[model samples]
Target: MTTTRMPRSGSLPAVRRAALVLLAGAGVALSPLPAQAAAGGGGPSSAAVAAAPAAAAASSAAQTVVSTALAQKGKPYVWAGAGPNSYDCSGLTQRAFAAAGVKLPHSSRMQSKMGAPVSRNALRPGDLVFFYNPVSHVGIYIGNGQMVHAPRAGDVVKVSSFDRMPGFHSARRLA
Candidate 1:
């Protein structure tokens, strides 16, 4: 049987889609510098060039995570919900990245410690943004300085900005 894959436009934030379209239009490739190239002795090796696609795939996975999180917007925020419907702070992040094939703990504090530390200025789309002194809240960044997350009980999953989040602490990249 032939299957059709349709673009889920509603799930993608406009900034993400636009950036992706621009990247696709530009035909950009990121070729990392190999030891030889770093020494100024030769051009990037085939391995370095080959790895670019993997990096791109990784980025795509991150985008998928953000889209998944965005799709969960408006879902009810439960204390420990981690599912197709409702979600908690870390649960939302957990389920989002899980869709991208990355495993994450359910606790925001635990998830915060899993990925490399990302400085506020260096954050990119797909980085996990954490909040509170003890890392009590987590959100999936979706570019344009915004993130999608489960705020609290009686509230739904929503988009928030770093400047507005209470006690903004740190961020991490899982993909």
Candidate 2:
């Protein structure tokens, strides 16, 4: 019986591929991709199929983080607010990650220290971007160089270009 072959690893979506890599790095078992099969023996092994769910879950979590944050756009920016209506910089990020089952501190500086540091160029949707010297402000990256954030006391939650934000302290990947 001929089994259907799976796509090459390189062809997987960026998020899924990244998840697979992370799961592998975390010591999750994974079988070789169909492309790695020798000769005509090319199909997804049971282990390869088994690893797909975890990768998909990771991708889903990232999307949830992004969607949750984006939903708060236009909400008022209130100091120390972290809820269904208004939010502060770190509050918005904290709430977003929480929707995806990831816990993040309520302070931008503390959140900055939670996940793996990501270079500006490596940012993807759902990454947490920070600003200022001591990382006093935070935002959720939503791709295409745009991030959702609570700018200040008078500003509402909105999408802004990370490149234009003054400090550009750093970015971190939590999902």
Q: Write model 2 residue lDDT over 1-175, tens digit each, in one string.
A: 2122223667666665565466445433333232110112112223532332211122665777777776676788899998767789999887777665455678999888766889999888888898989789999887766777889998787777667889899998867
RMSD of each: 17.7, 16.2
lDDT, residue 69, model 2 = 70
- TM-score for predicted model 2 compared with the true structure: 0.68
Q: What range of 10 consecutive residues in model 2 has the weakest lDDT sum?
A: 34-43
The number of clashing residue pairs in each candidate reads 0, 0
Candidate 2: give the clashing pairs.
none
The segments of candidate 2 whose C-alpha lies over 4 angstroms from its true place after superposition are 1-58
Model 1 weakest lDDT span, ten residues long: 32-41
- Local accuracy by lDDT, each model: 0.65, 0.69
Residue 77 of model 1 has an lDDT of 89
lDDT of 1 by residue, 1-175 (tens): 2122223556555554444344334332211111110011121224522332211123665766766776776678899999767789998887777665455778999888875688998877788898888879998776655677888999888776556677889988655
> What lDDT is obtained when candidate 1 is compared to the true structure?
0.65
Best by lDDT: 2
